[model samples]
Target: MNADRARGAGAVRSPSTATFLSFLWPGLGQWYLGRNRLALVYGLPVVAVALAALWQLNGGLADLAIQLFAPSFSLTVLVLIVLLGVWRLISMADAFTAAPLRTKSSRRPTTLFAVLALLAVIGHAAAGFYAWSFYQAGSKMFVAGLGGDFNSVAPGASGSGTSGDLVAKPGATPATADSRINILLTGVDSSVGRNHALNDTIIVASVDPKSRHVVMLSFPRDIAGFPLWNGGTFSGKINSLMTYAGLHKDQFPDGPLPSLIKELGYLLGVPIHYYAAVDLDGFRTLIDKVGGIDINNPRAIDDPDYGGWTDGRPLGFSLSAGVHHLDGQSALAYARSRKGNGDNDFTRARRQQQLLVALARKLTDPSMLTRLPDLLAAASQTVRTNFPADRLSEMLSLSRQVKDDAIQKYVLGPPYALRSTDATTYSLKLDLAKLSALSIKLFGADSRYAANAPASPSKSP
Candidate 1:
């Protein structure tokens, strides 16, 4: 107490002590001011979350934030930070001017403030723990890879010092840094609401470690090609194979992806070893989490009934020819759009390939490294495959080695594919001969492919 309070019958107290307490801790000043309940509510969560975050930076909580399915709290943090600063300022002001507080024990609820403080700590700690766990899981997923092996005649030589029976090729082999590997990246529309598995995009990616080349083979969704998978032929476009296999996932435990890859291998005459399938929902979310991409999407005509104009309403989608940066929704439209001005499914496939190229290019930019964790996490959520973590690293290296324009896209439509004039339309036939040669040249010789059929030219859409 000040001298004024000591000598006089009634004296006002200085608020400096209250200000000091508030400065030391957000709610401490409020507590000293006799607002115990409010102090607890403000102080505890901040301390707990801060401590927990420091402890588990790479655990479940991080994973949750980074995953495509999880919510992003960056904006939330920014807002909370602003509130914290303002709250501190208010506490300091109230403390400086308020009377030296001395409340009777009966005047305030002690237990409630303590309880609130404890609860805040627990809640924030739990959030931190979850974030840590999320980051841990997400990191693992980020480094994961997909792979495939085929019944091929082992190459003539072994890799360096032989550990066992290893195959060697003239230039590089699939296992070697110099060899080549071909994989199919498929985007399937198989959400719960859709009630169907539609192959939205098909891309054949060839990775050549020797020449440091990455090539793309694109297949259109609507091209009239009889589906070829499981060593059998079905009606309609190649994109419809997933629906057929969805009904049979139980019969074939490995999933329709492998079967579909095998069929595409037959169509392209390439030794397809690995495949990756991603859902559109996760893909979009993934893009959103990373702040989006800039892809030049161009078009001329606007189609009112593009993609069958769902529910008899036009898609209201139109774009004049130009370059632009895209957010999640825009990127999704860029990848899925093939209605008004594009050149059918083959053209659409090429456009999809363009998006992939753009992503690959942007991934290496220095500005993107900060978002790497989130990017990989999103990719893992959207994608599933047999490729391993090491192979993914190799791919990163491959991306750096190859330039954008160097990656040539192979499309299946008119020449390598033929129209089947059966009672049921939409039957496109593969000219096995040309595909066989191209496959061998790109992927090397595999018994499964064996350069089958008569030589023919590739079809163009």
Candidate 2:
């Protein structure tokens, strides 16, 4: 009888101890109970999952976190997280069952097991929520079929057509499939009182993936008297092109934004593969989300007539020359203010570029992990892009390899564009000859003008 009682005591101890061990790690309790084969079955899968996660994080956590903004990847992670939680729970239960049963009534062991299970559930639920948030943000930011052929639909086509209906027209340059990638970045000025959104900022970022070199071309909003893709000339400010095209869809069949993108690509003599349009208000919000940005002001800015578009008030902006930390409102003013002494669209474009680099640097910092949720939310509201989400990881990796010195910035002002008053209002007339030469210098064989000129090898400056 004593021997049986001793065995019963040992059995009761095994259940409580083994259950606690499994709670710490899947299959740990089975290992403790000498179930070696069963332990490997439970533990090896967990180990494999962990290893796979590390492998996928090849660019580190910062890059992986950014990749979550890809809807497909985020959704996959969500499913994996649920499966991982279930696997953990099953491992714990299996461990408890493999242990000897208790003879006496004891509540402590059951209570401990229940508490651990609750924690596992809560942890997985939180992870799933974050994954879902990323998926939602990506869906809002990346528009499907927005990267279609530039001049697919004919002028005067039905406005009811969708982006997917766009097909490449003959002789149209197919989106570049070589070492170079070109993306058009535009900042739209939109607010409650405005009837149309004006693309106040238009910049084309051309990157050479192999060389890790980037060229930024900034087109002034005042650029007018320029040739359009349809063999017509535009007399109004380039900033108003999108709105103009939308209202005159009979003349621009592919809709407003696409029309503007196509025109710019034609002008630049390169195939612009993607576009990202950011609302000015959303730009401010994004800057704030990153805790603002630091910029080196080469000259002082004091705009007396500055109507604070970001602040929604009449607060003018003033800043001294030198390094300065700016909040969202101030950064917007710095990028948008043209009424200041010696300030014009050209200078504003330069400042905008400075802000862009600063923001990119801030976002890639590891410290951004804590602020990711808010950042993603701001991005969803503030920006729209046709850039492929699946390629985000590749871009993120490439961005890290690119250094500041390898980036060349150009503003199509002064020598590149002559100020003309021939029109009713002052405008900038594009010097196409000069621009074509510049294009050939930058893009080499990729430039449309390359057929006539000897293609010069593009070198990093």
- Maximum-TM-score candidate: 2
Maximum-lDDT candidate: 2
* Cα-based lDDT at residue 49, candidate 1: 58
Clashing pairs in 2: none
Q: Which lDDT value does model 1 have at 29?
A: 67
Candidate 1 residue 152 C-alpha distance from true site, Å: 26
Residue 309: error of model 2 in Å?
Answer: 5.5
Over 1-461, each residue of candidate 2 has an lDDT whose tens digit, in order, gives 44324444443447667776776778888777767667788888888988989998877888788788899999999998998889888888877666665554544467767888899899899999899989988878877544323222211111222332222121133354336888888887776687767788899998898778999999999899788878689888898887787778788766676777777878888877777778888888999999999999999999988887544666677899999998898888888998899999999999998899889888888988999889988988887776778777788778888999988999999899989968778789999988878888888878776677654544324
User: Total clashes, candidate 1?
Assistant: 41
lDDT of 1 by residue, 1-461 (tens): 64323422344333555555665667776666566666677578667756755553443332323331222343344345455555655656555545444444322333443444454446545544444444443333332222211111011111111111212111122565565687778786765567666778888787766667677887766545443534345655667665555466554333444446656665665556555666676767777776777776556535454442223434655556678777666677667766665446666676688887776676556566466556656765666554443344446546776876667777866676666666475556766665555655545444234435346423321
